[model samples]
Target chain A: MEFDLEFALETVGPLLMAFLQVTLVVTVAGSVVAALLGLIWAVCQRELPTPVRLPLSWVLDVIRMTPLPLQLLFAVAIFISFDGYRKFPDTDVETIGMILGVAVFAIHYSTYMAESYRAGIDSIRQGQWEAATALSLPRSRVWRAVIIPQALRATLPSLGNWAIAMFKDTPFLLVILVPEMVAKAKQLGGASYQYTEVFTVAGLIFLAASYPTAVLMRKLEKKLVY
Target chain B: MSDFFQAISDYSPYLWEGARVTLALSGGGAVVALVVAVVLGLCAISPVAVLRVGSRVIVEFFRGTSLVVQLFFLFYVFPLFGIDLPGMWCGIVGLGLNYGAYGSEVVRGSLNAVAKVQWESTTALSMSWPLAVRRVIWPQAWGLMLPGLNNLMVMLVKGTAVALLIGLHDLTYWVEVMRKDPEVGLWIAYGAGFLFYYLIALACSSGLRLLERRAQRRLGLAPSKTRTTRATAEAVA
Candidate 1:
């Protein structure tokens, strides 16, 4: 049977376009948060005293120990109940909900990335730190000039994959009825009674969007000259 | 007082049943993933142009989509085309296929890492292709792939939660069901769910860590992560 291209386009056109922004915005923002905090965590993990480090580990552990969706839900529920959020009064609950959803996901992933960064950090030689020391490079300069850039290069493939995951995870915001891609399809289906076409189109659209990156990942994985 | 105990005592049966479903999905999916990985892995490395291109595209297609989305597609959409199947089984199949594609990549990567010299050595030993594969190649390929397989197994366990989306009475689904009671208390509903997932994930990770340690011991491999960090950390410090 032939596909209904026009019907699929009309239904998905708006939803896909809007949700695409939401997904990209959330992913880019989340990646920014993850990179900054994860880098800080990785850097501090080495030089910090055990007292500060030990408690920080516990916080990271709790974040890691929980599921992302639960954390998302918890963050939304807590934030939506706060006095400032309540005082804003005119704020869109759904936007607030979505941002909190993305933030929680970012925080959760950041902790994991932090650990991954630590692994990447530790993988660097002990001699490099001594050389930086011998050069009398200031601590911040050493980290800025030398350490973090290399650490992040190693972290990129994972961080990129997680960003891809974060992009896909925008659909989970549908649990809170945010108008994400899946939610858009759900709304269209519920309104138009065409769940099959709507959801299928949504998936295909996402597949279309994601295909380029996945292919690029495979290609870059190859051609490792070193 | 007895509320926490009652909550536990009441849900133990449901929890056990949920655990069983989780195990069944993970076990079935890992087996399917392994088979799929081997086939796709072989095809991915095959000299035949069509096989190579066909396997890469198909693997990429599955890996790009969300597993839950795929699970929904299998459960909801296929039936529209008149392919009747149980939702749980669809979830099983989807999880298997989704992970299979990923496992295939890991498989290919691991197999590729085997030194080129081994094949020459095997050829010199006068072993046939299949024999060499069975003896020299498979063991080394397996040794390299085991850590990856271990990681994938942990994912498959976590992935079992997607079953909840397809209306499976997995732990997450049941917990949501149980929590529907206003008396279940939001904290209890969520805390229980969190605890269950954490325990399962912990169990799976520890099991994987054991397997990884075992693989490292048997094959005596140091994970590359160790050295890369050592070099960089020293360079900066």
Candidate 2:
């Protein structure tokens, strides 16, 4: 029950480096998926026909409302159940789990990304659309040349915010045993019975990564606002 | 399909009970978060430098870390310090403080959004600071804050799913328990859990939407930009 500073440091200090790699991998891979898929979602929500829009909207709403853990669980369960999954060699299963984890992370955050993009798009004046039309620009050209560039400036700050959020959230993959930093911390804590120190180190690691990034993000947001 | 039905029918009662616990935890956490948000939010904007800095540190520390770690810390680490509490309390407090840090920003943002003249007019009245804030600023800020707060409440409801790790028999836990049964498939179990969470969030958001409309009506800010202009007009005059 007592704090053991020396033991905790010795245990976590080495393991943190190993696990930090996993965390960074998931964050980078997931960010790519989220940034691309989220833009697609945002564009589709605005341009798709009513028949497509109505159901897609409802599906995104469900994803947004539900917890990520449940979604990740669903993904893991479904992914591993395939006959091909069993046939895959060693480490493949875990690799598949990591991929599914990224998919879930990307999918979940994309819903939010869509909302921010929509807000940015909406903030664009009605006059912009009319001007594009009066210029006889094709609809695609209007969106491409006229709209998306302006929308992106507004979206960058929010996208960066969600990236930071997704980075912190990568640890939730531990439920599926993705071997990220917190999972590593938990394993060390369980083995050594030094839950306080190990967990404190883990929290510090998260803050160290997130806090400075957030400060930079606020600065980025202010810069974008101008 | 038949097996899914059998699983649902078999676990329906347990699922209902777990859903009740989930709702209770989320509802309680939301209330706790709202109060903390108001206090800390006010503190963050207070004229006192120490109060502002103190609140900022607390808010950013909570915001920077993952909620799961916070829960783990409260549930696992706190007991070592002789501050042991039950799993349920840990869940409530952890969720409250983490989300409250977020909600405080919502509160501060909306408060700041209130016209600067309102604050000047309050100063002009020579009333106590609290009275001026309560009467002059809050009415305008409340409407703006509702949308952000409603969004936080939805996130909090989904956030309660972390309680499963701490061994609370919330909706997610019940779903997990059912999934362990050979008869209950994983899809059925986790799908039901997702649907339950979605429904609860939908209900809360719709309720908040109603409150938002009413607040806007009271402020006479609804039905477009004219009301904003009127407010600006008042500020000018």
Candidate 3:
């Protein structure tokens, strides 16, 4: 019924611990997976023949268009079904499974990231491609020496934005019982009926963590502008 | 599989109901978002310093926090403060405020994107501020902002899936419920859910693109043949 400072303060420690242990872990790992896989998707879409590219783009579109929570549920279901209903084993296997589930976040965001990468690649003028051709560079050499470095530079800020987005979405991991910050706050709140305090603190933590990075991305975007 | 098809046929009614709820949430949230976006967006670009600063703080606050926390706050915490919003209202408010903050940026950007000459021309005509905005600035900015808003609409449709957490019987919730049945199977339940969501998103985007083309045509600009998707992606990124 009222704001309880003591209980709110108490919830912060466990929530922060969960943020570091689960939320931060999933976000960092997911960002890595998304960046790598997204670049691969971008490159393949760009260079591969239409036969290979068309289906790949369609698959990525499906992944992008669906809700992340649905993807998370689908992923956890597949994990459970494949493992013969050995749900959340109390071992390293649980950790491994959680990582695998985090891949859903990666794959989902990778579609967006791939779009940014494609935009970056497209921004490269025809003159650059012609220069590479004019130099008689090998096909692989042109991509490696001339193309990727430039695209990566242009896309860096947008990629950081996606990482921040993935950070916020880490809470969706709750659907699969991943014990992230919000889920921990909910569990802690259930004991005292102080959902207000716990959720407030959790939301503030998210704002505190993400806002600075977003501002930095804005600055970087300005710097990168030609 | 026959079992998958049977499960779908057996639950088609429920699935359709869920789809309807999802659509309603998306539509409601979008209305709220559009209202919030236009108001806050206009205030964001207002000449008054206080209005600009106030809207900036509000937008950043909503944008900075995760939507899940916001939904939980409205559903759970606000009631503690005697606000007592319904679960569906919580979902709508949460989605609207969060995406509205993002959409406000789109609105602000497109408004700014209108040429400075347009603003000067309004002044040259001795037009009142509201009239100038309504007549001159808005028409040009509308077409420009539509693509960005279109992207946000697709994102909003996907975002409606989170309403399931608030106990809304949206499509995601139904798919989740069906997934609990061992016979229905995760593959079929989730696969069908994915297909439905994809279709909804595809429909929203294509619909918006048509609207965008019409707006551009009304502005007497030729519909751009390319770079629309790129522009939308860049705006969000």
lDDT of 1 by residue, A69-98 (tens): 556655655554355477767977767766
| B67-108 per-residue lDDT for model 1 (tens digits) | 767776677667667886887688678878888887887777
Tens-digit per-residue lDDT, B1-237, candidate 2: 787777888888999999888888898899889998898888987889999999989988888888889999998888878899899899899989988888888888778888999898888889787897788788888898887788788888988888877888888778878777767777788878877899999999889878888989999875232112111111111
Error of 1 at A211 (Å): 2.4
Per-residue lDDT over A62-115 for candidate 3, one digit per residue giving the tens place of the 0 to 100 score: 998889988888877777778834544565654754686579888988998898
TM-score of chain B of each: 0.82, 0.89, 0.92
Q: Which is the better candidate, 1 or 3, if ranked by lDDT?
A: 3
TM-score of chain A of 1: 0.89
Interface RMSD (C-alpha) of each candidate?
Answer: 6.7, 8.3, 2.2
- Best-to-worst TM-score order: 3, 2, 1
What RMSD does model 1 have?
4.6
In terms of lDDT, the poorest run of 10 residues in model 2 chain B is: B228-237
Chain A TM-scores of all predicted models? 0.89, 0.93, 0.95
Using Cα atoms, each model's DockQ against the true complex is 0.35, 0.50, 0.63
Off by over 4 Å in 1: A51-62, A80-88, A190-196, A217-225, B1-6, B177-184, B220-237
Clashes per candidate, residues 3 or more apart or on different chains: 21, 0, 0
Better of 1 and 3 by DockQ: 3
- Tens-place lDDT per residue, model 3, B1-237, is 787789889889999999998998898899999998899988988889999999999888887888899999998888878899988888888899988888888888888889999999999999987898889998899999898898788888999988867778889888988989877878788878998999999998899899999999898999964433433433333
